[model samples]
Target: MNNNEHLTKRRGMTAEDLLRLRSVRDPHYAPDGTRVVFVEKSIDEENQYRSHLYMWTKDGAVRPWTFGPWRDTKPRFSPNGETIAFLSDRSGRTQLWLLPTDGGEARQLTFFKNGVRDYVWSPDGTFLIALTTLGDDETIEDREEPEKAEVKRADLKPRVVERLYYKSDAAGFLDGKRAVLARIDALSGKIEALTGREEEIGSFAISPNGRTLAFVANRNEDPDTTFTRDIILLDLEKKTEMNLTNGCGTFASLGWSPDGMKLAAIGHDLAYLGATIHRLYVFELERQTKRVLTADWDAHLGDAMVGDTHADAKSPGPIWASDGSGLYVTASERGRVNVYFVSLDGPIAPVVEGDFHLYGFTVHPNGRQAVAAISSPTSIGDLYAVSLADGTKTRLTRANEALENEVVFADAKPFTYQSTDGWEIQGWIMKPPELGEGEKAPLVVEIHGGPHAMYGFTFFHEWQLLASRGYAVLFTNPRGSHGYGQSFVNAVRGDYGGMDYEDIMAGVNAALNRFDFIDKERLGVTGGSYGGFMTNWIVGHTDRFKAAVTQRSISNWLSFSGVSDIGYFFTKWEIGCDVWEDAERLWHHSPLKYVQNIRTPLLILHSERDYRCPIEQAEQLFIALKRLGRETKLVRFPDANHDLSRTGSPALRLERLRHIVGWFDHYLKGPFG
Candidate 1:
C-alpha cells in the first residue's frame, strides 16, 4: 500500500495511462464525523469523466455510496446528518438529488427548466438554495421549457450583442439572462424565487441561523466598466437586501460565523489590478461594521496556480470554526498551497504547511480535523485527513493506485538562481527517469500560462508525459508568478516581455549549467496563454531553441484587446494601457510584430471556441509565419475553449498530448529515416 510503489521498477508513463488515473476530490465529513463522503472521478469508456460518491471511514473502509455512470458531485451531509444532498445529471439535466444516509432510494428535489448551477442546504436542512440563469419570460411555460431549442442551422437568426460583456470563455455568448438565487423546500418540493427579475447573484452563503444570506453581485449601472463588486446581505423573512461592503472592494468566499453574528470573506481592493493579493475580512452583523484581517499578508489567499489536470478540482473557501473564534483558509505562498488559521482580531498562522498543493479541503465540526485533496509532482492526487493541531496528514484514500502501479513518476527537484538583473528566481527540473550513464537528454523549457500563476509542485500530466518520453522538463517562477510577494508578481505588468523574459532565460542557463545531462543543442520551449505569448516571443527573439509549441497564445496585443473575451479589460489591467491609447507600445510588446525573426520550427495549438486569447491569435501567428516561408503548423481543436488541454474531451486531450510529443520528437529526439 505504499504510495510510491509505482516509482520502483515501473515502466514509462503514457498518455493512455491518464485515463486510468482516478481523481479524488470534494471530501466532506459527515456531521457525526464517523464517516466521510467524497467523489471518485475516473475516465469512462465513453471518453467522459464520471464522478460518484464513496463512503470512507477513518479505519480505511471504503464503499460506493452512489452507483451511476452520470456525473454526480458536491456531496454534502445535512446538518442533521439524516440525508445527503448532491448535484447530479442523472435525469438528463444537472439537478439537486437527496438520499437518506441510512440507505434508501434517492429523490429528485428540483426540476428547473434551466437546471441548477450550484446548490447549498440551509443550516436548518429545510431548504435548498440554488443559483441559475433565467430568460426574459418568467411564466410557467418558460420555467418548463427545455434549454436546447430545436432549430436548423440554416434557420438560425443573427446574434446581436447589446452588452459590452457579450461573451465569456466558460459560458460562451452572454444570453442577457440574469443569474438569480431561488429557494426550494426540502419536503414539499415547492420552488420560491428569492431575487428580483434583474438581480444577478454571483456567489452566496446561508447564515448559520438560516435567517439571512450573504451574496456577491455587480449591481452597477454598467457592470462591464465596473470592476468592483459588493457583498449584499439579504433577510429571508423581511425580503429586504442591504449592501454590506458599500463599494469598499471586491469581495467573495462568503462564510457566516457559527453564531451568525459575523461574516468572513476574502477579496482585494484592486491595488495591483488583476494580480492584487487577496486579504481576508470579517463583517460584524450586529454593529454593521467590517475589518480587514489579513491586510499585512502578501501572498494570494486562494488557489490560483491552476496546473492540476484533475477534472473535479474544488475550491475550498474559508471554513468557520464551531466556536466562532477563527476560520481556516487556503493560501498560495511561494509555490505551495497551505491552510491557515485566522482570528477575527487579526491573528493569522499556518495550520498546514507543505511543498505540495492542497487544492481542496473540508473542515470538520470539531475544527481540528479536515479532509484535504492534495497533489504533487510525483503523485496525481489523494484525499488525506489533516490534523490541524499537530500538522499531521494521514492518507484517507488511494484513488490512483492504478496510475501509481503502472507509471514511474519523475519527481521535480527544486533549484534557485539569480536572473540577469540579479533577481532570485525559483524553479524545478524533472529529469527523465532512468537515463543511461553519461547520456544527455533533450531539454524542454516550459512556461506557465498565467504570467501571474506560479509553476509549483502540482502534478501536471503534460509534464509527466514529456518527462516519460525522455525529455528533461525545466520550469520556473518568473517575476509575474504568484506565491511570491506582491512586488514580484506585479513586476511583469507594463513589461510583458521585458525582465520576465530575462528571468526565464536565466533559469534555463542555470538549469543547463547545473545538469550536465541536458543537451543544450537540442533544446525546446513551449507554453500556453501568457506562457504561449512567451513561447512566441522566445522564438521570435532568439534561435537558441530548436523547436517551440505555443498553445492558445496571444500574438498581437492590439488585435487581442478588441477580439478576446477578456482582452478589453484584461489588456488594460495587465498591460497597463488600452489599444487606442498606446498602439505603438502594444505593437512593440507583441510577438507578431517580430514574426520575421522566428527561425525555430513552431507548432501552434488553439481551440476553435477559445474566447480568452481567441483562435485569431494562433491564426495570425500561423499565417504570418507561413507567409514568410517559415516552419509552422496550426492545430485547432473543435468544440473546445481556452481550457482544451486540461478539461476538454478526453480523446482531444490525448490527441493534443500525441501532437506535442510528436512535434518535439520530430525536431529534438529522432531521425525518422
Candidate 2:
C-alpha cells in the first residue's frame, strides 16, 4: 500500500471508527473571568465511557483539572474564586463536592445517603443552597407521624379539565408531590430548611446584601399558572416572603443589578395578542415600581409559543455588569439568541450579533471580560470569550474534531408541507454526501419532544450520524414546535396528537414527494418523550413505516399523571382538565389505545433512571407491544434519563446512536452496517 493509503487506513474511514471523539457542553467561566471550565467526554480504545473536567486560560490553553474513572459535571466557582463546587457520583451516589482551584483531591460535601441533584452558592460566598428530595428516612418517618398533620387552612379548590394535552406523557393524571428548597452554610456547613411548601422552585438568586433570596416559585402562586411560576422574595433574617410577579405565566430567565436595586426578567408579552415578546422589566426593589427596558422598541419573541416564550436567539435577556453600568440579555433576530449588552436607560444595542444561540456567559467584576457558550445551527457549543464593549469573540475550546474530520451532515434543505386541512408545516431534509448508482436511500422520520418545543437549526449528533450513514433524515417543527408565533405553538396545546399527527405526516409525505431519492418501501419513525407518544400514535393511525423506535414516550396519559412528577400541574395547564373529567380525551390521545393497530416492527429505548419521562412509560409501551405479539425489542439504558441522547454517559450516548442506526439499517438501509 502507498503512503496515502496507509494514512487513510490510520484515519477512521467509517463512523464506527470515530471512537476517539468527544463533545463539550455547558461551558462556564471562572469567577476571575480569566479562565473557563467545561466537561469533556470521550470513549477510549476499549470504548469505556470517560469524562473529566478541563480548564482554559482565556487565550485557549486547555488542560484537564480532574482525573479519574468517575464522571464530574456542573462546575461552578465560588464568588471569591477560592473553591469550585460540582456534582459527582464517584462515591456511588451523585453528591455535591468542593474543590480548590489549584487542584487536588475534591472533598465531598453532602452525605445525605441518597444523592443531590442541584446546588448553588450564595452571593456572599458564605452559604450554599441545594435542592434534593427530602424523602430521607427521617423526613419520611416524620411525615408518618400524625403530629405533623394540620388542618387545611385554605383549600386548593382544584379546577376541572377537558383536553388531550392535559395528560402529559410523564405525569398522567398529574398528582404528585412537589420539590422544595433547602439551604446550607458554605463555611460553617450548617443546614436549614427554607421552605416546606409543596411547590417546585424554578430558578433563584441571592440579593446583593445576601439577606434576601428571590426565586421564581409556585410556593403560594395562583393555581391557574401551574405551567408558570411567580417570583418570590424571601427575607432570610426576617423569615418573611413577598410575591413580586404575581401569578402570571412561566418565567425562565432573570437578571439582577450589582446593588440589587433593580430586577430584570424575561417573560410573557401580555400586552398584545399574536405577539411573542420577551419583555425585560426592571423593578425598583424598595419603591415597588416596574419599568420596561424595551418599552420603545418592537418586542422580539423568537418562537411559536403563546405570547413568545422563546428567547431572542441573540441574547439570554440579562446578566448585569459588575459596575451596574448596563445589563446583558440574550438578543434575537429570528431564531438566534446572542449575548448583547443593553444600557440600563438607553436603547438596547447589540454588543454581539449573528446566527448563533448563546448561554453561560459570566461578566467580569471589572466589566472588561465575558465568557459565553456559543454555537450555530451547524456547530456544537464550545467555550468562547467576548469583549463586552467591542463584542470581539475568541473561541476557547475545540471540543469536537469529529465533525471536522468526518464529512458530517449539517446543512438542511428547508421545505414546508401542508396538512390534510391545508395547514402549512415546516420541515428540513438532510441527505448524505455520497450517493451512488442513483440508488434510492432509506428514510427515517424523526420527531422532537416538547410538543411545545421547536425543532429548528440546532446541531444534533444522532441526526448527523444518521445522515452520514446514507439515510435521508426528515424532521420538522409542526404546529406545536417553537420559533413560530404563539398561536402556532399553542395550536396543539389542547389537541396534542390530533392535528399534530397530521402535521408531521404531511412533512413525511412532503419529503417522499419532493425528494425522489427517498425509498417509501424502506421507512422508519422514531422520537423521545412527547415524540415517543406521537410515534406510538402515528403507528396506530397508519401502517406506512416499516419499523419504529419510541424512546421515553407516554403510552397512557391517565397512568402518567400519577407515575410521573408534576402530575398535578401537567394535567391542568396543557389539557385544561383532570383525568376523570376528560377520560375520553385522554383515551383518544393515548398511543396504547390503538396499540392493536401497530404492525410495524417497533423498538422501545428507555433509560431506567429517567425521572422526567420515567422508565415506566417505556415499560408500558414495551409490554403492550409484546402482548400484541408484534415484532419488538426493548433496549433499557440503566442509570440514564430523558436527556440521555444529549447528555448521558458518552459511551451510552454513542450506543444509543449505534442502536438507532442499527435499527434503521436493519429495516430501512438494508442492515449491512
Candidate 3:
C-alpha cells in the first residue's frame, strides 16, 4: 500500500536500508544456489561513481565483500568454489583481482598499463579471459615533444586519430591495431597473450568445456569500413584459430549450446547502429548448416551480452522445468516483449502480458521462480518475480514507492486517435493525482527516442519524476515507433518530421480533448534524441507550450550529417542518401526549418561527450534562441554520452535530472515569489 510497505523493509531505516534503496542489477545465485552477489552503485559528492560488491546469505544477511576504499566491483564466483574473480581500479587502472570466497586477502592478478577492460572466468576456473588493450606503442618522438613542437608558445591539444569508419558513442574511434587478449592463470599469476594480432576482439563466448573461444573481430582487415569485425573460433589449448561466421562482418556473436554441438547467434545483414537487426541464426556446427531463427522484419534480437556465464537460452537452456517439458524465452511477439514457453519443439504462448514491454529477465537456478524488469512510459522498470509453473506475477522492488509516497502517479490511460488521413494512432494519458477539485494541471507532452523504438509498459524514471511534480504527462508511439509491427517502425525511413510529426501532434490533441484538468495555456514539452528534435519541431510550429526543454537534439540536418560520426549512415538510412546527394531533403526535415516561427522559452540539455547527438546540435539551437531574444539556457554535462539519462556516469545522470527540473522550475513551474 505504501512505499515502505512495498519495499518490504521490516525495521528502522539503517545504512543498509539506504543501500537497499538503489536498484540491484545482475543478481545471480551461486551454483549451489546458496549465496547471492550483486553490484550496488551510488553517486558521491563530485557526482562521480563509487560502486561496491555485496554478498548475501541465503537466509537474508548481507555483507560487503570487495571493499569500496577504492571502487571495487563485479564479483563473480569461480565454479570450483575456491576464489571469486572481480574487477577493481584501486590500482589506478581497471584490472582483474581475485578474492578467496572464504575470507582471504584479495591480490592483483594482472599488471598491465592499459588495464584489463572486462573479464570472464573460464568455466573450469583455470583462467580469466580478458578483453583489453593498451594505447598503441608510442616512442618518445610519438609523444608530443614540447621542446621541438612548433606551437610551443600556445597550449597543445592531443591529436585524436580515428582508425576506422564509424566511431562508438562510449568508445570513440577505432585505433591503431592495439587490442590484445590475455588469459590470467588463476593459480600461477602468469599472463599469456592469446591474441596479439593487429585486431581487437569485439564480442566472444567460451565453449562449454572451456577449451575453445568464439568471437567477432577485425584482424588484418580494412580500417576504412565501419563494420569490420569477423567472427572467429580459436582453440585455447592449441592456440589455433578458424573463421566461424564469415562475410557477415562489422558485428557478429556466437552462443554455444549445452551439447556444445550447436551455436545460436545473430549475423548482421545490413545492421543499423551496428545493432537492431531483423534476423537471428542458429548454426549446427556438425551438419554445417545455418537456420534463420526469425525472418520477420519487426522482430529484433535483443543484445546478446555474451557473458562468462553460460548462455541461458541456448544449450543448458532456460532452466529445465523438472520434467523437461518446455523452454522459456522472453521475446517480441504479436505486439509486446513477452515471456513465453514453447514446447522443446512446438507452440509458443505468452507467460506475461499487459501494455508494457519486458527488457532484462533472469530465471531462478532452481527453475521454480523467475525475476524480470517490466516497464512503460510513466513507470521505469520494476523488479518482479513469478512462478515458472503457474505464471502468477508478484512485484519485488518498489522503485516508484518513495516518489509515489509523497506524490501520486497520474493514471496512464490508453486511448486511440485518428492520424491525418484516417490512420489510427494509439497513446497513453496521465492525469496528475491529488489535483484540487477545481484546479487544472499543466500538461507535459513527452516524445520517445528510437523513432523506431516502441513506447510500452517499461518505466521511464523521468516521467514518474515529472508526474510526481503535479504535471499531467502525455506520451505516444508515433507512426515510426515500435510494438505495432515492422511497417509501423520503419514508416519514417527517408522522412522524419513529416507524417510522423503529424501522427504525434494528433495524439497530443486527442489527449487534450479527453482530459478536462489539462491546462492548455501552461503546456511544457521535452524529450531526448528523436523526441528532442520533435520537441524543437513542436515549439517551432506551435506557441502552445509556455516552456520547453530539448535534450540532445538535432537542429540542422546538414550539420547533423557532417558533425555526427554516424550522421553519414543515419542520414543515409533516414533520408535514403548521403548529405551531398540529398541536401534539399536534409534541409526539409531539419527542425531548424521552423526556427523563425518559434516563440516559447526553451532550455537545451546536452552532454559534452555525446557522440550520438553531438553537443553542437544543442549549441545550434541555443544560439538560435539567443539571437531571437528568447529566454533560453544551455546545461552541459562534462563526460556523458547520449545514454547519460539512462546509464551514464552516475553523477552526470543526477545533474541531468537536476538541470531538467531546475529549468522547468524556473520557467514552467516558476518565477516563484
Candidate 4:
C-alpha cells in the first residue's frame, strides 16, 4: 500500500474540474527565436470550448500545430520565419489562417464580411495587418461571395441606436459595425482599406520601418462621448496622418521600436476616472516627443491580474527589447503579475518577479529569452522559458499536467491587514483540503470584478471550487484594487458603498484573525461585476453572510444610469454622480439603496445577455427580494454575457459552477434536504 501511497493520491478540485482546465494562450516568438506559437484552450466532451495551434521547440519539442474542431487563435510569427498568422474558427467565421512553417496545407487567409477581428505581421513579409468589421455599406468587394460569405441570417434589424457606445459585454449589439484597418495580401489575399476611419481602431502597431502605422483611435466628436484614445501615426507609404496623443490621454498597448525611433504606450490621464493607473508612455517618432515611462512607477501597467483562468490572455504590450533595451511590461505588483523591465533611460527593473501569474509574454529574439504565459495558485496555465538573464524558469506546457495529476489544489495564503484608514489590505487565504484536526472550515467571501481588477496569483476556478467544497476561501485587494497604487485605485472611485465596503469587511476580519480554521458561524458571500456590486453591498449592509451569490450584478444606480453598457459613463465614472447630476448621489451609492437591509440567503446569478451588469441588475434584486419575503433566488444564463463567470458558455461555465456550489451548499452546509 505504498508506491509512495500510490503515487500521492490527490482528489479535491471539482465542479467537473472545469472540464480538466487547459487555457495556455498567445505566446508567439518564432521570428527565429527557435519557435513558440501557443493557444491551447480546452473543455469539450460536448461542453464545447476548443482552440488549437501549439508548437514550442527549442528542442523541448511540443507539437500540434492546429487540429480540427476549430477555434484556433492569435498566433502571429511570420516575418519570414515562414508563415503562422492564425485566428481561425475553421472557416465558418473568424478568418485569417495561414500555417506553413516548413510544411504546407493550411491556407484560407481572409474573406472578410465579418470575420477576423485582429491580425498583424507586416514588417515586410508582404503585408497582413487585419482587424475586421465593416458595414456603412460594407466592402472588401463585399466579401467575394463565398455564398455571400457563408450566410448565417437572423438580423431582425432594429438597433438604430446612435451610439453612446452601443452595447458590449464583449461585443453584443454594436451592429453598426466599425472596427476597420485592413491591408492583407500576404501573398494575394488582397483586402486593402487600412483605416477608413470613423473611429474604432484601438490598439495597433506595425512600424519597424514598414512605413509607420501605430493606431489606437477615438477620433473625438462623439466617439461615444469621449475617453479620447488618440495615438494615430499612419503614413503606410504616404497615406499620411499624424495626431500622436493630441487628444491628450487614454492610450493603449501599441509598442514599436527596434530603431523605428521609439513608440511604447499603455496609458492614463483620465486621472482616476475608471481608476486610472496604466502608465509607461514614450513616443518620440522623430521629435513629436512624449515621455512618462512609469513616472516614478506605481504599478498597473498591462495585465491587471484578476483570474478565472486566463482565457484569451493577450497583453504583453510594450515588449520591444531586442536591442531597444527597455521594454517588456506586465506589471500589477502586490498580488503579483510580474515581468517589468521598462528602461528607456529611466529605470523600472523586475524582469519577472514572483508568486505567479505573468499572463502572456514573448520577446526572445535573443533579448536573452522570455516566452511566459504562467499562472499559479496551482497552475491551470503553462508555457514558461523566461531567463531574461537570471530570473530563470523553464517549464513550457504540461498544459495542466494531467490537471495537476488528478486534482487537489488549494494553496494561496498570503496576507497583509489594516483596512479603512490604516489602508494596507491585500489578501488571499484558501485552507480546506479536507480539513480535520480541529475541524472547522465554511467561509467564502471571494469578491473580484475590477473595482479595477487585482486578486493576485491567478488560477481561480471559483476559488478552487470553494476550497473543494469545504469552503474557507477569502480573496482580497480591496479599496478599489489594482496592485495598490494610484491612490489605492482612486480609492474606489467616489466611494461606492464607501471604503470599498470597509475594504471587504476588513478582509473578513483579516480572515477571522488569520485563520483558526475559519468558520465564524459558517459565512458565505460571492461576487462578479464590481464583485456583483459588492455581493449586493454585503447583503444590504451586513447580516454577516450566511450565504449570498450575486454575479453580474449592480442593483439600481437609478436603473444603472439608463440600462448599463458602461452605464452612461460608468455612472458618472464610478458613482461620483449623474442621473441628471445626482439622482440623490446615485441613490447614495446604490445596492438597491440598501434593499430593505437584506438578511443574507440570496443567490441571484444573472446573465441573459448581460450588457455588463444588465440582467436588469438581476431583475432588481430578484424583485426586491420577492417583495420583502427574502430568502431569495433567480439564476438566469441563456446566451450569457458579462462573461458569465469568465468567457461563459461551456455549459454555462459548468452551470455557473453548480450555481455557485449549490448556493454555498444550501446556506453554508446544514439545510438542503
Candidate 5:
C-alpha cells in the first residue's frame, strides 16, 4: 500500500516499535557531490542491530550499497571518489573494508588482531591512517597467534587494577592497551605503526597536503591527573613530532584547513573544568598561534542534544570551507543543534537553522552543499541536502517514512518558565495524541542524563512510547544543561541537589500550571546518570511524585567518589571537593542521607557493567529503602553498561521500557491502568 493510504490506519506508537525504527546517521558526500553514503541501522529478528551502508545520488534516488548483517559504519569516500572505505565486523572483528564505486565486491583492508578503531583516508588517497590498540608489552609487528589453546574459564587471571582511569562504562576494564596510529597502503593492505604504544591517542587528522598529522593526546608524566589535551604535529617525512598546543588546554575534533597551513579544533581550557563550553580554535601552522573563533559565542560548540535513537553520530567540528574563508560546525543553542559558519576573521553565522537536530553531516567538495542527517520531534532522522549559501534544506531521504505512516507520534510543545532565582528554564511537554478533551492524564517527568546535555527537538522513542500510553511526558533543560549559555550550563556544579533540584521541581509545577490536562497528583519521575541523581534527590526531598525510577544513578557522593570510572576527578570538578577534602559536604549532597524521607514508590534500574555511576549506587539506594521498609524494587540488566537506555541490546532496551512503563502504570495510574 502507498504511504498515503497507510497513514489512514495509523496506530499509537508502542515500545515494540523501537525494533522497527531505523536510525540514519553519518552522511558523507562523495568528492564530486554526485552521491552521498550513510549508515542505516535497525534491529533484526534476533534483536541484534544491523547497520548497512546506503547510497543516495543527486537525482534523489536512494539504494542500499552494502548488505551486511553485521555493523558497517563510518563510510567515507576516497579523495579521488573511486572507492568508499568503512568499518565492518563481518570479518569477526571491526576492520577497514573498501567497496569500489564502479561495482565490485567489498574487500577487507586491515588484518590487525584487535581490529581497527578509527580510520581516515589520506589527502592523495594512496594510503590511509588508522587507529588500533596494542598491549603494553605488545609491538605493532607482533603477529596474531595461530590456533592457541583455549584456556578454561576458571583459569583466567584476575584483572589487576593500577590506573585511576582503569575502567569505562561501555569499554569495560582497561587491559593496559594504548591506542596507536598506523599507516596502511590502500592498494596492498600493508600496515606499519606510525606511533608507539606509550600513550593513548584521542583524535587525529591528516594534513591536506599529506605531509603532517595532527592528533590530540595528553603526554604529561601523569596524564590521568590532568585534563590537558595537546595537539601534536607529526612530520611524515622527518619522523619527528612536536606539541602544537604546548599544553594550553583540552582540545578535540581536529581538522586541517584546505591550505594545510592551519588546524581547527574544538575545546576549552579548564576555565569551568567539566562544565567548560567547547569553543572553536584555529592554529596557524607557520605562526604557531591559536585563535578562538567562538570566544564570544555563549552556546556549546558541538552537538549536545540528548536522545537514544542515534548511534556513531559524527562530531560536527570545524569543516573547513574549500576557499579557506571559514568553517562550518554544529552548535547546541536553546534546545536545538544547528550548523553554523565561522569565518577566519571571527564572525560566526548560522548555516542551517531549524527546530531539528543535525546529528551528522558531510560537506560537498564544491563547498556549496552538504548532506545532513536531521531529525525532529516527528521524524526519526533522514538525510537532507543543505545549501551553504542560503541555509536552504531539501529533504533527500525518507528513511522512516513507513514507520511514520504506520504509527502516530505525539508533538512536543516547547515552553519556557521561571525557575529558582527567576532563571528561565526551557522545557517540552508531549501529550497523548488521543487524549480526550478535559480528561486528566498522568504526567511523567523525564529527566535527561547529562546535566550538561539538553533535551531538544530530537525524536526520542521512549518519550513517544510514554505519550502513546496515555501519559503526558514533560522534559526540561534545567540549569547545567547545554544550549543555554555558559553560565546556565555551569550552574549545576557544586549545587547538585540545590538549585538544580529547584529548577526541576519548578518545571514540574510549570507544566501542571500550564497544562490543564495533566494530573499533578499522579506524577511520575525518571532519569539516568546525573538525571538519576536528581531523581533520587527529588524523591527524598519531596513526596510530590507518586512514582520514580532511577537508572544508573548516584546515591552517595562519598562512595561514588571512589567507585565510578570518572569518580575521582569528576567529583572534585563537579562537586567542588574530593572525598577527603570535604566528606561532610559530600555526605550532605548524597541522596542516601535523606532516604528515610522518601515516601514515593521508587524503582531502581541499573546495568551490571555500568562503571560510570556503577551499579553500587543503585544497590546502596535499594538496600537503604528496603531496610527502611519503604516500597522500592531493584531491576538489574546483565551484560549492559551505563548506555543501556540508548545503545543497549534491542531486546534489553524493550524490556527496560516495559519495566519503566509497567511501574508507572501500577503506581501512577493505579486502578485505572
Candidate 6:
C-alpha cells in the first residue's frame, strides 16, 4: 500500500464511537506525592455509565486501583497515605468505602439512610465528615397511618409543595429534606450529626490543624429572595462557630492556609447579578478581616471552561503551597483554564498556560508537581503531570489513544474580530478535513449556553459529530460571554437579544468572509440553554440560516418568569425588569413575539424533566411556529434535565445527535431535493 493510502485509512468519528470512548477525571495526588488516582467512566452494554478508580505513579505505570460492575468514585487518600476512601454504590445504596494503600479488600464505611452527597477527610484522618440529606424516615414512622399495608398507602397520595424552591434540575421534586453536616468515626463506624441547623451547606474545607472547619451557607429566612452566602468557622474541639463572611454576596470554594491562620475563597459583590465575575479574597482568622486577592484579574476564578461531553468534572479549590508561600488556582482566561499561583502579597502568576480545559487537577503536598485532567477540541480528557517550576506537562495516561489515532478530527483555529459596536470578539472555526478543491462545506454556527459562558478549547462530541458529517462548525465568545472580563459577561444583561444577537451575526459573517470553503447559503445554527435562546432569537430576527435546532430554549419571558426554577430571579437580574413591572418590555425581547419572521426550518429539542428552562418553553415555540404555518418540529426527551445534551442517558444522547444531524442534513445538505 502507498503512504497516501495509509494516511486516508482513518474513519470519521461517529456517535457510537464517541460513546464508547472512556473519560478520565478527578486526579488526586497522594500525600507522599508519589501516586495519583482518578475516576474512569465508560458506557456499559446497557448504556449506563460505570465508573472505576485508576492510579498513576511518577516512575511506575498507570493501573486500575478498584474494579467492579457497580460504580465507584470520588477517591481521596488519607492524611497518612496508608489508605484511600471513595464513594461506591455496590451495596444498592451509595456509601463511603475504604481500601488499604498496601492492597487489601475494600471495607464499607458510612451507612446513611439517605446517600451521602459530598464528603471530606479530616486533617487527622480519624473521621470522615460528609454532607447528607437529613432524612424523615424516623419522623414518618411516628406519624399515624390509617392503612398499614404499603399497597393501600401508595394508591393515592397528593404531593404538597410549600417551599418556593421545591424542585431542582438535578434532584427532582424536593421531599422537605435539608442537607446537614455529619461526622463518621473511621474506626468505630459511628455517625454523629455535627450541625443541628437546617441550613444547606454550600461547601466546606478542613483546616490544616484539624481543629476547625470553614463552610459557606445561606442562613437567611428566605434565601431565594437574595443572593447571599456567609462563611462560618466551626471549632472542632469547642463545638462553637464564628461567622467569617457575614452575609456577603455568594461565596464558595473555601481554602485554608497551611498555618491555619488565614482563609481564601472566590465570590462576587452581587453588583452584576449572575454575570458577576468571581474575585479571590483572603480572610485573616486572627484579625477577623478579609482582603481581595485577585480584584484586578477581571476573570472568573475556578473552572468556567465548558466541555459538552465529560464523565465527571470536579472543581478543585485553591491548593496552598506547603511552605505558606502562595496558593495555586485554576481560572478561565480568554479560552484556556490556566493554573495560577497567587502570592500571599497579592501577585498572581500562571503556573500552567495552554489552549486546553483543565476540568480537574490536584497539587502534590510539596506543591512542585500536579496532575491535571486536560482536554482540547481534538482530544477527549486524559491525565497529565504538570511541573510548577517550568510549567511543563507530561502525559500520564493514554485513556483514548486508539480513538485519538483512528478518528479523523478537524482542527479548530482561533479567530478575533470586531463586532458591530467596535468591541473585540473571540471565536473558533473547525473546517471539515479532506475537503476537495472547489468544494465548500455547509457551515453550522453553534452557540454556547450561559450566554455568560465562553466557547473554546473544550472537547464537544456534538461538534465533532457535526464536523465529521462534512460541516464547517463556527463557535464564538460574543458579548456577555465570560473569559473576556466582567464587563463583557455583564453586557448581555438587560439586552439579551440586542448586542448579543449582533455579536453572533458578526461571528457568522467573519466565518463566511475568512473561509472560502464555507457555503454561506447552506447555513445551520444550533444551541442549548442560553445558546438555545439565541437560536430562537436568531431564527426570528433573520432568514439567513436554512436550518436551526433549539434545545431547552427560552421563547416567552413572561411565562418563563413563573415556570422556570431560576426564572423569577434571573429575569429580574438579567432582563432588568419583573413580569408585573414591565410586561411589554419582556414581551418585546422575547423571540416568540417575532415568530412570524421565522422562515427557517426549526427543530425544538427539550427534556421533559428540565426545570431550568421547562419544556413549556419549547412547547410554546413549537406551537406558535406550527400555528403560523412555519416549518417546525419538537422532540421531547423523557426523564432528562437541562443537561440532556451533555450528561443525559447514553441512549438519549445518541438519539439527540441523530435528530440534530438529520434535521440539519435535510435542510442544508438537501437530501429533500
In terms of lDDT, the best-performing candidate is 5
lDDT of each prediction vs. the true structure?
A: 0.87, 0.68, 0.66, 0.82, 0.89, 0.85
Q: How would you encode candidate 6's per-residue C-alpha lDDT over 275-394 as one tens digit per residue?
A: 999888889888988888888777788777666666247778887888877788888988888889989885799988899888888988877788888889988889888898998988
Q: Which residue segments of model 1 deviate by more than 4 Å?
A: 1-8, 139-150, 197-200
Looking at model 2, report the run of 10 residues with the lowest lDDT sum.
Answer: 305-314
Instruction: Return the TM-score for candidate 4, rounded to 2 decimals.
Output: 0.34
User: Candidate 6: which stretches are off by over 4 Å?
Assistant: 1-7, 136-153
- Tens-place lDDT digits, model 2, residues 449-568: 876565555555566677667777888877766655556666776676788888998888888888988888888899987889898899988989988999888888777766665545
Residue lDDT tens for model 3, 629-665: 8778899998788877766665566577677766766
* Residue 293 error, candidate 3, Å: 2.4
TM-scores for every candidate against the unseen true structure: 0.97, 0.77, 0.83, 0.34, 0.97, 0.96
Q: List residue ranges in candidate 5 displaced over 4 A.
A: 1-8, 143-151
RMSD of 5: 2.2
Report how far off residue 267 is in candidate 3 (Å). Answer: 4.8
Q: Tell me which of candidates 5 and 6 scores higher on TM-score.
A: 5
lDDT per residue, candidate 5, 1-673, as tens digits? Answer: 9744554477888999999989988888888889998999989888898999999988889999998579998999999999999999888778899999999999999877778889999999999999988887787666444444798888889888788788877678878889889999999988888998368687899998898988988888888888799999999889899998878899999998888898999999979998999999999979978899889888798889899897456655679999898889999998888999999875789989999898997899888888888999999999889898898988888888888977888899999999868999899999888787799999999998878888989999999999989999999998999998889989899999999898999999899999999987799999999999999999999999899999999999999989998998998888889977889999999999999999999999999989999999999999999999999999999999999998998888999999999999998887733
Instruction: Look at candidate 3 and tell me the lDDT of residue 213.
Output: 82
| Residue pair clashes in candidate 5 | none
lDDT of 4 by residue, 27-121 (tens): 88887788888888887788788889889888898998877788888888778788888888776788888878888788897888788778788
lDDT value, residue 134 of candidate 6 = 61
